[model samples]
Target chain A: MKYGIAYFPSKQIQDEVNSYRKRYDSHYALIPPHLTLKESFTADDAEIESLIPELKKIANETDPFNITINKVSSFAPISNTIYLKINPSPELQTLFDKLHSGKFSDDADHPFVPHITLAQDLVDQEYSDVFGSLKMKKYDLGDEVDRFQLLYQLDNGSWTVYETFVFGKEFV
Target chain B: MKYGIAYFPSKQIQDEVNSYRKRYDSHYALIPPHLTLKESFTADDAEIESLIPELKKIANETDPFNITINKVSSFAPISNTIYLKINPSPELQTLFDKLHSGKFSDDADHPFVPHITLAQDLVDQEYSDVFGSLKMKKYDLGDEVDRFQLLYQLDNGSWTVYETFVFGKEFV
Candidate 1:
């Protein structure tokens, strides 16, 4: 009954990111490398089915946008989530804004900080091991955000895509 | 060819806002009191036509969110636009993001700051007058955002709605 919206990276990039996530995060096997839009909300099958038309409309109108992953960063000294910092971009922000508005609205109380999580909830040794290895690691991961997906988690603590909405056609 | 996405307020609020805008803004009569999502973009008729389905989808998926106008503010020193300040709401931000991300993407290069413009390009005295009057006046103008619209401007500098998209049914 709970669902969220997100953008999954390409296979090549996902594989590389997941490899790191597996070592650092316990939930790595439960999910994939993706950026979340709407975090989580409860909904039934009928409700989700009704939303397809609207989701399609949003996808159709949206143009593909490119995301650039500049470097690895951490929410340290406060939170334990290590993430890939997304470069400042107008397009990404715009896309983020839309996903949270309208019928897809959710409780996003915190300020929008655009990042893709690489690892989280690490202890001292684990954090040191991951950060030590990743501190010197610089990434220039780039990809076109052509589609955003709706995903849901089962009782078994696994996430799966409910639907994938592609950006609408570009007007010539 | 040039278009903007916006949300129109109630007639009562629109009238009140427009009264102030007309006195301080030269272009007040040119448009109504509305919050803009996508500022402006050039598109041919055919291109816009093709975007209807996508726009509809977005509109359908979006549930209407209420907007609360807490006070008046200005974009001063940097810009000369005076407007009503929108209280920070996740719904508004989400709606704004969806509008710009889909096929309806436009040339909004600036950061997304949600405000309803009352006056712009005012003379020094005019700016001072409007700012002085508004700074003392508190506002609590609130309205439900049932729908968002796509609007186009005419050659004579007037505007008209090309389409109106309503939010999907809300589950009880």
Candidate 2:
């Protein structure tokens, strides 16, 4: 069977107020659209399902929060993995910590590090050589945080979004 | 099945090495250490078999080329597509041209925008923000072109090298 992500989830935060989208009937649990990345893996779906209860529990006692996607980083400090890093505000951190520590209900839960994976293991001399020579330049604009999505794997081994929810903000 | 890559036959040239590795007593055509990335996905055995001949043909006659992974790049340019862009080298451009123009065996083809994907796709923001902020600081580190590989898909669907073949420096 193809894997899937269920329920609402958060990965990054948005900057603009309008970016937030909601899940459930409550307007408080919203997601930032700008932070929403594309598609997801089966592994992601499973993990999110396992974390719902704990996340709700935290949100109950905690004040609403905001998250910000801050910088980009490299895995080997040079080679291999590369991705974007998120920095949630303090209130967001409390929720993140609760979710991360007991994030997934799975028996084999993944340790949450709060970063979005841009690419994983890419190594081939011909491929890497071409990759290695690249000189990436950066440009940031007035961007905002959006909602996070729950992703799933389809029968064709493709990933799709199961759902999206906002945090700390209400949507139109 | 476990996804993997195999380098086979010989690296002297693509067409010249095509049938060598599968010849009994040619175990040398394999990648022993099984180069792996930290967050790699696994694929089933049978699924990966299909891509072999295709990768082999690519290794052969692909030509001696230099490419510029000149900088760290994100897909969608403004957004993330979970891949890095490589500046196709002139020699490699010759290959891309040949492939795009149907110069290679007409059946063996692809629109050649030579690039090695850094990550499969940005699903979870595990590191998207961090990776996004990274600007590939350009620097040249001369390394020899060794061999190319034929990768396989594991049950989990991540790719690994199943076979490989080396190229002689005099291949040109």
Candidate 3:
């Protein structure tokens, strides 16, 4: 099965993002609004089962951190994906590095750029038109993320939760 | 620093437990309602940081599981811990075993008992009085848990979140 790791924002943030996504995003229904932490990778059941203990330790060491979205941005030239740009934090970078290290494989096509996609897979005309107006609008939103989910894609191309991990110390 | 692993239930469950905890549990204000997965262990910052990658692998392999609390129970001779009993599940057992195995230490004072403490640290007279009444009332509460937290204790005796691991796969 194919799985990916991501941070799902609070419902308030999801609702706000959906308002724009409903009109512009082709993948609005495929999954909920989220910030991708690790890009998707392939693994079988046994391969994944063996990795759970290590994942718990990663979560144990990670402290929950805040991400602020002050502006809308786009992956132009590279792709027509427009997103709510998450302000970078050291904690986020550390998590990205951990996911790509050790037993896990690192096969990222792009360098880590923290974001929650609001609109994606658009034609060039729509992309330009949407990105033009949306970039000017203000979006000062933020949330403390304590957990990230492991997700798998369904036969219908929709995604569902496979597991979740919260950021914090477990020794107490 | 002293650290431990635990599962914190939903707000509704927390509130319900707190209703009893406020009056009975001496350590109520020290922390919220939780199910302890790994008992306390000592580790410095560097030692904990080194374990993050392995923790991530653990969270990746596990799947989100459910716990049901249909009755009130207590740890009488073991200790004066009054709790809402969580019926045993294979997933819980598997997780407990993983936390105890490999890089982590296993120094459990008691065998694994899945529960959320509603009351603790009571005198014998108080313990009997409380358990007698609370045990009679039914509590058919349940929640789907996808994540667990690592916590550390503060100087003032309260515990704070250090990290959290949600059970799931990361490869997609």
Considering every candidate listed, which one attains the maximal DockQ?
A: 3
lDDT of 3 by residue, A1-172 (tens): 7788888776567777878887888876566678898888888879887665666678878888888889999998888999999998889999998989888888877789999898888999999999999999998898998877776654445454555665553321
User: Taking the candidates one at a time, how many backbone clashes does each contain?
Assistant: 18, 88, 49
Using DockQ as the yardstick, the better of models 2 and 3 is: 3
Q: For residues A102-158, what per-residue lDDT tens digits would candidate 2 score against the true structure?
A: 544333233334444343345544334422432152423222333333433322222
TM-score of chain B of each: 0.92, 0.45, 0.94
TM-score per model over all chains: 0.49, 0.29, 0.52
Q: What tens digits encode model 1's per-residue C-alpha lDDT throughout B6-101?
A: 877765566677677767776664556778888878788799877767776776677888889888899898777899998888988887777777
TM-score of 1: 0.49
Cα lDDT tens digits for candidate 3, B1-172: 7787888776567768878887998876566678899887888879887766667678878889888989999988889999999999999999898888888887776789988998888999999999999989987888988877776654444454545555653321
Worst 10 residues of 1 chain B by lDDT: B163-172
In terms of TM-score, how similar is model 2 to the real structure?
0.29
Q: Tell me how candidate 1 scores on lDDT.
A: 0.73
lDDT of 2 by residue, B100-119 (tens): 23322333223444433333
Task: Report how far residue B56 has shifted in candidate 3, in Å.
Answer: 1.3
What is the number of residue pairs that collide in model 2?
Answer: 88
Candidate 3 chain B — worst ten consecutive residues by lDDT sum? B163-172
Tally clashes: model 1: 18
